[model samples]
Target: MTDHGPQPVERQLPTEEARDLLALVRDLVQREIEPGAAEEEEAGRFPREVFRLLSASGLLALPYTEEFGGGDQPYEVYLQVLEELAAARLTVGLGVSVHTLACHALAGYGTKEQQAEHLPAMLGGGLLGAYCLSEPSSGSDAASLRTRATRDGDTWTIEGTKAWITHGGIADFYTVMARTGGEGAHGITAFLVPGDAPGLSAAPPERKMGMKGSPTAQLHFDGVQVPDARRIGDEGQGFAIALSALDSGRLGIAACAIGVAQAALDEAIAFTAGRRQFGRPIADFQGLRFMLADMATQIEAGRALYLAAARLRDAGLPFSKQAAMAKLFCTDAAMRVTVDAVQLLGGYGYTADFPAERYMREAKVLQIVEGTNQIQRMVIARHLAGAESR
Candidate 1:
């Protein structure tokens, strides 16, 4: 783990509007988000009402431009909103994050006409979006994706299946990456396809280990039709677009990891302080106290990593390496802290009586998504190697 001495807490210089936006998010999360987390997760139910609630609060479009009926919030401010939402409910946070990434492909790289056509519906219409980049044979090595899109007059027909899409069948639109040219990364292109287009279908969700409330399914595009105007950026720019979207999305996942870790830590601390053992509260023990300290330390560190990455994005600097570092570090820390929280609670932690069990399960997926921690290491090492590749 990248260790540094206990750093001072970060204080961001947000404008007044940004501060108010964050406060609004915090209030909404505490009031409406956390209360239903357990019930929704247990039932494997999507919280559609929660999405409407967030959209009404103006958070669903925080990352987009003001012209699109969005908040036009800075990346730094937007990530803080994600952190608060995630701290309340990870499923909802992930859904929002994925939608934001899907939107990124259009908002960041699309033509002005493309933006005018889709940004309003995507940003403020109370609808969800999905990114279709991964395939059955392509996860970490996303450039190997085999989904194809072929030109047919003024239209393009997309074929093949996308694996592990977050919104899957529920989204109104999808930002899909498919091979349009020869091979490797440079051949890929991104398209904006309506979810209800002919020949579009999604398989039933995969039985996941966690994030039960968020759907995950394979998106099948069997001759699905998309207009030429729906394409994002020029041909061969899709791979670069996908990678850039991931660089931002990684920060989102890292914020989520810290949220889950914080939730687990809170539960652990509360339980240890109240549960009596050997005629005293278990928290009275120095060993347990040290463990709690470590958990808190991990939470703060994870927060720092993602916030640092967000600050870089806000400053218009290169943050890809730092974003990967945040995702890798924070997810690993969440796994460690949540597992220990379970250990601290003994058998009770293993059971559903406490949220730590759920927290532990949630932490595992963060390591795997937005590129695996293994991929993160490769990304970091590649940055270190630069042009010196053997």
Candidate 2:
């Protein structure tokens, strides 16, 4: 099987261990994931086995504390791993990101007892997880979510639907946010709901334009019962926890965007180099050459932006604004780069015969997920404008 694909990226990892880890990832991607990405994606099949392999190899829990089955790798290192996985297949990369987001509330805010009880299996025990924050009416305005949780003695009953959930039906656990008090952000609370709870169910997955292999569906909680022990963070602190998770998850989205852009650029480069036009390879044409150069430049810039944000996070510095910026720029760059890739390939790019069209389709959703690029600009602008008057 000839992999007429992109060359491996030359990454500047911070440590020899990180370098080794990336090398292992690259090898696995080339041999296992990349080969079947197009075929499976075309069939709209989720690669559950690949996820299992990632979990078994400790690749799934790279950024959390090692005390609870995680690799304790820095955010910088973890983001790069996401980039590599996304370059092979966006489903794998984004899936890992959402899983990490799902674990954030418990890992960062759960009591020691909760962490001791659940962190190990959630981190590395091959269990997949989902984060539920968005509802049908409240995506950008997340604080307006309508999911409700009511306490009954020591137990809580969750009701309402979570929309656009990744891994909706298949996840073993879900980190859910439900209104528990007044009618605003301060009212919401987080809970870890087991997938098989009696009244918990998933609607059919959405018919999406790209990344169809990744399940995106609506989850319903019909009076699902949860113990108080499953609650994450103090009551009324779920919105803050959700925002904190998004800050890190935005970096993951940025990395995934760059990876997809890089992959598209690589495919365009490979195709043009061997393709003949006017008695020579098209790569010799100055017009086409400039387009390739611009694509490469955008990918590099996006990678640098995301890495800078990741490093800030690793240093425990304030990085929310930078994270928003990275997500905005990288996803926009991916959309542009993938479109250029399609144009460079001419008619072939328009068809499913090549991956350029798929890349183009995949790049679009990046702008909309995690947070919309428009929402990202608002976030950045708020940081610049100082705190709101309220």
Best by TM-score: 2
Residue pair clashes in candidate 2 = none
C-alpha TM-score for every candidate: 0.95, 0.99
lDDT of 2 by residue, 212-247 (tens): 999999999999999999999999999999999999
Global Cα RMSD, each model: 4.2, 1.1
Q: Report how far residue 311 has shifted in candidate 2, in Å.
A: 0.7
Predicted structure 1, TM vs. truth: 0.95
What candidate 2 gets wrong by more than 4 Å, as runs, is 388-390
- Identify the leading candidate in terms of lDDT: 2
The C-alpha lDDT values of all candidates are 0.86, 0.94
